[model samples]
Target: MSGQRKNPQARDRTIGAQLKALRQEQTTLNLEAAARAIGWSTATLSRIENGKRHITSEDVAMVLTTYGVPMAQREELIESARTGVQAGWWSRPLPGVLPDVGTLASYEASARAITDWSFSFIPGLLQTERYAAGLMSEDGAEPLEVTMRWRARLQRQRVLPTIDYTAFLHESALQQPFGGVDALREQLSHLVQASTRGLGVRIVRGRVPHRLLLHPWLLLDFPDAPPVLNVELNGSSVFLHDDEVRSYDNMRSMLDGMALSSAESRSMIGQLRERL
Candidate 1:
C-alpha cells in the first residue's frame, strides 16, 4: 500500500473543494500554475482538488497561503480541516453496512442545505427508531447491526437543526408502515411536528407522476463547495458531483412545484395518523 487513502472521506473532499474554490476565485493562475506554486504535480493537485485523494490540514494551509488568502480566513478553514479529520462514531466499521454510510453522514454534517427525495420509504433522517429498525430488520441485517445502524442514523439527524433541511416524500411513503401500525402512527405524528422543529416535510401526493421520482436521493449543498448527490442503494451509495448532479437539482425544483405546502402536509399526516 502507498499509505494513501482512496475514495476520499467527506472531510478530505470538503477541504479539497474549499481549496479548489479559493484557487478559482482568489487567483488567476490555472491548475498547473497553481500546482507549480505549491510544488505539486498538476495531476496530484487535480486529484486533491476534485476530492479523489486525501488531504491534510497542513496541505490546506499551504494551498491557501499560496493563494494569498488572509490569515484570518485561512485560520477557520485550517481549523475545519483539523476537526474534520478526527474520527467520529461513523468511522467504525459495521458488518453489513458499507463505508459510504459513514461518508454520507459526513457529507450531511458539513452541508449547509439538505434536501431528501424519497419514494419507496421514509427518508432515514426523519425515521423513528422503531420505524428505522423495522426497515433494517426487513433488509435482513443482524439485530446488532440494526442497533448500530440506527444509532449512527440518529447521530446524523443531529445535523438537521443546524442546516436548511427538507424532505419531499411520496404519498406512497406515508402508506408504508415499516414498523407496524402503531409505530407508523408515531412516525406520522413526528412528521407533523417536524416543521416546528425546523424541518420541512412536504408530501408529494402519489397521484402526481414524474420520471425523477423513481428512486430516493439526498442532495447536500455546501457553503464553499459544490453540491453532492447521494443515492443510497442496498448496502452501498453512489455520490455524484459536478454535471452529474444536474438532474437531481431539477428534480428538487420539480418537487417544489408539485409537493403540498408544509401546512397541507402536516394536515395530511395528521389525518393519516388519526385513521391509524
Candidate 2:
C-alpha cells in the first residue's frame, strides 16, 4: 500500500460492494441487524454499504469480526481498505461550477466503459470548446464560470481515449446551432473525425416515438464495482446504482438496435455539414 496509489472514491466503492456481498452471503442478518451487531447506526452502515461514506481499515475489521467472517477473508478486505488515497482535481472543485461535475468526473476517471444517451444536445465529452461555451451562455452562466466549467470539461474529456466511449445522439441535436452555424459545422466535423477514431458516434434518427427515448443520462461501468447511472437535472444530478441501473441498461439495448452504425452516422454528419 505504500508505493501503490489508488483513487479513494473508487476504492471505497469496490470495498463497500464486497462488504455488502459478504454480509448478505456469509450471514443471515439484514442491514439493520448487521449494524446492530457492529454497534453502528443503521444510517452510517447504509452509507458505508452504498459507498457514500469514507471507510477505514479498522472499520472493515470491525464489521468482518462482528459477522464472524473467516480471518483470511477479513485480512484481504482490510488490506484493500488500507490502500493510500490520492486526491484528484475534483477534490478542489472549480468555483461557481456545479459541484456534481466533480463527482461525475471522479466516476468517469474510474470507468472501464461509458455510454452517453442524449436527445437535445451533444454529449459533453464530444462537445467542442465553442459549443460548450455557447451552451453555458444560453443557460445564463457568468462569463468567468463558463470559462472555468469548460476548462474542467476539457480535463474530463481526457478519459475518452482510455475508456470505451460512446454517444447516442438524436438527429435534432445536430440541427441546433448553439454556437452559431459555423461552430455547429465544426462540431459536426469533429464528430465525423471522432468516429474515424475509436469513439462510437451512433445517431438516433428523428421522429422516433417519444416513448422510446428519455432525458440524457450517462451509464458508467467499472471493472469491479457495480455500474452507475448519472441523470442530470437543473443545477444538480442523481447517481443510480445496483438494481436502479437496470432500466438504463435496457434503454441502451434499445438504442443500440435503433441507432445508425458508426459509418452511417459519419456519413449523415458529413451530409448535414454540407447542407449547412
Candidate 3:
C-alpha cells in the first residue's frame, strides 16, 4: 500500500478501482455489456477501470448513467471523478524543486507535440547545456543540484528529434543575453542547429509594432488527447485545458504569422552571433 501511495500512476489506478466498484454495486453487467451500453470500447473501459487512463466528467456521466445510477448517486460519482482527475503525485514537494515539476515532467513526456511562446527567457528544450546550467545557477541552486537539473533538462530535449516542437520566441529573448555573451552565442547557435535538424523555429521580432497585445503562454498538444496550456509565474505553474487551449491556439497562430520565417530567423540569429 505504501509503495502504491508513492506512485502517481498507481494512485490514479486506485481511483479507477473505486469507479469500477461503483459500477459493480449498481449492476451485474459484464465489462462488454456495460461498455456497449455506454458506447465505449471494452478496451477503453478496461483501461479506465485499471487506472491506465484519467477519467473525465463525460466518462463518469456515461458510466453512471449506463449503470442506471440514481440522480443523487450520479452526482456523487461525478464529483468523485472531478477530484480523482486532480489527484497526482506531482502535487507533493521534492527537495530543491518546485511542487509542479513532477506534473510538468509527466505531461511533457506524454505530449506528442509542444508549441510554446516565450518573451523573457529561452524555452527549456532549446537551451544549450551551458546556457541551462548558467540560468539554473543564477536561480541560486547549488552546483551539484544544478548539474542534476541540467541533466534532467537535457534528457527532456531527447524528445525533440522524435516529436514535433514548434517554438515562437520573442525577438527580445534572442537579444537579451541570459548567461553572458558567450553563453547566449552558444544558445543561439544551438537554436539554429536545431532548426536545421527539422524543429520548427519562429522568431517574433520585438521591433514589430503592437506586439504587446497578447499575453505570453505555452500550448501543448497530445496525440488522441485534448490540448493543455500552461503559464508559469514566479514560483508556480498553472495548467489550462479545453476552451483555454482553443484560445491559445488562436493567439499562437497570430504570433506565428508575425514571426520571422525559418530562414530569416536563422539569419537573424546568425547576425546576433556576429555582434557577440
Candidate 4:
C-alpha cells in the first residue's frame, strides 16, 4: 500500500473552470472557434473545458490570448498557471527513495486535513526518529542517508502539531517489531504522547475483520478542494481522484468505526509500551 495522493482531476477542474468563465465573457467565441484559434483539437479543448484533463501553462496562455484578454488580465492568468505548475518542496529527489517523495511531501504540507490508514507499519508522519532511522536502515539506506531521511520524517511529523490529523493503525502495526523491542517500545510511547497532544490515533484490533482490509489507503482532504486517495506502493505511488475518493472515503469510515476510540487508543498504546 502507498501513502501519497495527487488528484490530477481536481487540478484539471480548477483550470477548466477558469477557462469556461473566460469563454463565457464573449458570446461570439464558441467552443470550436476557441479551440481552432488556439490550434488545439476540439476534443482536447472540450475535455479541458469539461475538467476531464489537465491544462498546461502553454494551453492556458494560448486560450487566454485567443480570447482577446487584455495584457493586464493575461498576466494574472499566466501567474496563476505558473503557480499551478510550480514544483512542490517534496518534489526534490531523496538519495535513495523515489524523487516524487518531495511532491507528496509538498501536498501533505499544504493539505488542510489528513486522514491516513496503515496496516503494516506506522505512517511516516507518526514515526519516531529512532523508529524512522531503523526502518530506513532496514531498507538498506546509507548511514548518512538514513539520518537525512529520519530528519525528513521528523519534519513531516511537525505538521501533526500544526494541522488537523487523523491516523488509524492496524493492531498488527502496533504489535510488530519495526527495529527491535526497544525501538517498538519507543514508537508506541511516541504514539501515546502524540495522542495526548491532539493528534487522533486509533488502532484497529486484529480480531475485527472487515472489508476495509481489502485496501489500506490514505485520504487527504484539502481546505478548498476535493479529497485525494493515495494508493501506496513499495516503489511508486498512485493518486486517485473523484470516483476513487468516494470508495476510499467509504472504506475509511468503516475502518474508523472498527478502530478504537481516541481515549481507548491512547490506553492501548500505553499497554503495548508496557509489554515492550
The predictions' CA RMSDs to the true structure, in order, are: 3.3, 4.1, 9.4, 5.2
Best by lDDT: 2
Candidate 1 residue lDDT tens string, 209-252: 66755568999998867788988777777888888999889889
What TM-scores do the predictions have? 0.84, 0.86, 0.67, 0.79
Looking at candidate 2, what is the lDDT of residue 103? Answer: 76
Residue pairs of candidate 2 with colliding backbone atoms: none
> Among all windows of ten consecutive residues in candidate 4, which has the lowest summed lDDT?
1-10
| Alpha carbon lDDT of each predicted model | 0.84, 0.85, 0.71, 0.74
- Candidate 4 residue runs with Cα over 4 Å from true position: 1-17, 20-37, 40-59, 69-73, 83-88, 140-145, 208-211
Residue pairs of candidate 1 with colliding backbone atoms: none
Candidate 3 lDDT, 1-276, residue by residue in tens: 111232233234445676688778879998898888888789978877865555666667778877888899789868765665444434453456653566565566657888878886788888987787777778777987777667666656766876788888887888767677889999999989988988988888756435433445667776645566777666567777556568678777787789889889888988988888
Clashing pairs in 4: 1-232, 2-232, 2-233, 90-102, 90-103, 91-102, 91-103
How well is each residue in 1-276 modelled by candidate 2, as lDDT tens digits? 123322236567878888899999999999999999898899978878887666778888889999899999889888877762444687677888776787788889989999998888898999998988898899889899999999899989999999999999999889888888888999999999999997999999967656445568999999988898989776678888789999889988999999999999999999999999
Q: Candidate 3: which pairs clash?
A: none
* Model 2 regions more than 4 Å off: 1-8, 24-29, 54-58, 61-84, 211-213
Tell me the deviation in Å of residue 148 in model 2. 1.3
Compare the candidates by TM-score and give the number of the best one.
Answer: 2
Tens digit per residue, CA lDDT, model 4, 1-276: 012433333445566767888898754788888888888778978877765555666667888878888889878877776676544434455565454455456556667888988887898888887777777778777888887677666656666766789999988888777678899999998899889988989988866455555555667787655666777776567777667689778777787788889999999889889977
